[model samples]
Target: MEIEAISRTYSPEMACVIFCCRVFIKTAAAEDLEQFVAYGDIDWNEVYRLAALHRVRPIVYRVLNNTNIPEPTLTRFRNYCRALSVFAFERQIESARIKQVLGQQGISVRMYKGLDFTKVVYGGDISLREFTDMDMMIAPGQLSAMVNVMKAEGYVCSQVEYLRRFPTNFVTNKKDICFYKRSPMGRLFGFEFHYRPTNFMMDQSPGFDELLGKDSSPFTHEQYYRLMVLNHGASDYYPNLRSLVDIVMLSQGRVVDVPPKLRRYERLGQELASRLLNSPAPAVPADKPLLKCATLITEWQLTATPRSGWEKMYMHIRFSSSFLHTLRLMLRAMHYFALPNEKDINNVQLPLFKLYYLAKPVRLLNIPSRLKKVFS
Candidate 1:
């Protein structure tokens, strides 16, 4: 019965309901089971057994918050929350260290995820949000140099085979998650330097010089700070409620002085938030529209909860297969969330689709002629 009570708190059409219920079953806390039976007349024991197969912490939190479960089940949720808090706190420390390191090197680094999030979201302290990487933006030409600096400090580039070797298109499509394992303390500390934003798929994105100009403008540091928050949530499509909250908290009463043209970008930020609270899960087609699915996923991640576990798994599959597909999906998902419309959907056309497609297959054959064409 308590399960029924818990289920009533969320949307009937929630894509993760089944997944959430599975988490409930895992606790196998008898008080939760008894409450479920008393309220729903359903077999709680069997459901708990089945839920063991899933790993849905978000759902588990929701159940404990919504249902009349036993104090022990509540205690388990509290413990989970405490652990996440500790993890998040450590991530903040790591982010601060990275900022300090970049400052020492005169690299002009700006924080995007991690500890910067604390200033954005309400209840961010207790929300089920965590940052795994300290994403910092560096100048375009300085990418290799920055990597070199990190490597000098014991950071290593990822060698996942596909990522080990990059093509001409890679710089435009993928942002490498460079890892730094600094002896013992460094093992727990790694930094991600993004030469390109997730919205690099945009046909008219500004260049590094433009970003520098905007950042260095006469506007106060607070205005630039707000701009970064909007850019991260809307452009990068970071998936977490706390991200929006970060923008809200950091930009509070500080957006009045933003440049006029830059303010236009805020529309996308607003759209991202609206989409999150409204339609969290959107049904999209496969194949030609794979980009559409990806954009939706990105939107949800930035604005709402992740699109769904299925969406995340699907993207992981597609991205692993092709770098071009990875970029395509990133672009499509962004458009779907930031600027969704049927007419807008019909106009989606990625310029590099053909060149990347043709180039990748020929490279695999090791054909001298086709390879020559690619390089030539």
Candidate 2:
């Protein structure tokens, strides 16, 4: 769809977001944005909120700093981008220190996601991307050694106590662990150590060895794009414009041979991007229900609309490729909620594991209230 068509179909806030976040805006799109800004009645506050929710505030600021937005809103975006630059610099320093510490122990680390994309895709402008933690992939066999090295370097793992008590169980079930430490300057840095790129059920998904290579080289653009697609599916399409934007940015000018099992998600992502970001539509048509649910969820996220628990579950189930996949996802979700995390145990003081598992449902009754608080 063209920019003008999107502006007509969606709100002006969404239209501006789509225009500002395109990977490569054509002359026609730029003219459309100018015309929309000149004539369309736009709510600058809603645009700012949407940009922040979509995690594309930096990109929006870069594209619209010279536009006729209110001064206060532009200043807010400018300050946010500046703070992100400082945080990115601190993370870079901390990441280097982590690599040195782990390298001394013979652990080969390959960074991925925002840490790598900020440099490779965004041309080293880390402010353009928002990421909470640095993702590092390591060999599965070296998990114990890696944890010990991180702990020795004063980094604390989030599940340290739980892992200590149930090392085998945790390692067998979970794919990653997060470790955090405060820098000397009082800045906190987080790193997620992953043994795998994604937890998708697709058999064609690449493993750590294939992604890292025998010599532990960096991932090629193709490998990274494959991971991004799997991750989008693994996350149930994530219900955000940034998720689709990442896919578009990575697949630009590239031929990504998505596996047959994961093509539906790729198609849905492409469809959403095409509708919102003016990217070319997918050659294959998307699943109608999945696309509709994804579109609704994305719009709700942009508007800060509260969603019911049933809606969330329905969205997750609709992302499944088949009935069997939906069943597996349902079972996995059940198991996840049943297993008591450290926070749950800390809050409840349960004595028996079976009791904790039994009480999980009762504990989840507060989730609605929590959601209300979040969206209030």
Worst ten in a row by lDDT for model 1: 339-348
TM-score of 2: 0.84
Q: Compared with the true structure, what per-residue lDDT tens digits does model 2 show for residues 1-376? A: 5666666766778778878886333313555566678797898888988888778888889888777778998999999989899998888878888888888889988777766777877767787888789888776677778889988889897676656666665665567889998888788889998876655233345665554355645666666666777776544465566777778777888887665666677777776776667678657554667677657765775455655645655666777767887897787666654777665555565556567676677666777578889999
Best by lDDT: 2
Instruction: Report lDDT (Cα) of residue 157, candidate 1.
Output: 59
> By TM-score, how accurate is candidate 1?
0.49
> Could you say which candidate leads in TM-score?
2
Over 4 Å off, model 2:
1-10, 23-28, 200-206, 210-215, 285-289, 301-313, 344-356, 359-376
lDDT of 2 at 54: 79
lDDT of 1: 0.46
Stretches of candidate 1 off by over 4 Å are 1-67, 123-128, 159-177, 180-188, 206-359, 362-376
The local lDDT score (0 to 100) that residue 370 gets in candidate 2 is 83
RMSD (Å) per prediction: 12.2, 4.8
The Cα RMSD of model 1 versus the native structure comes to: 12.2
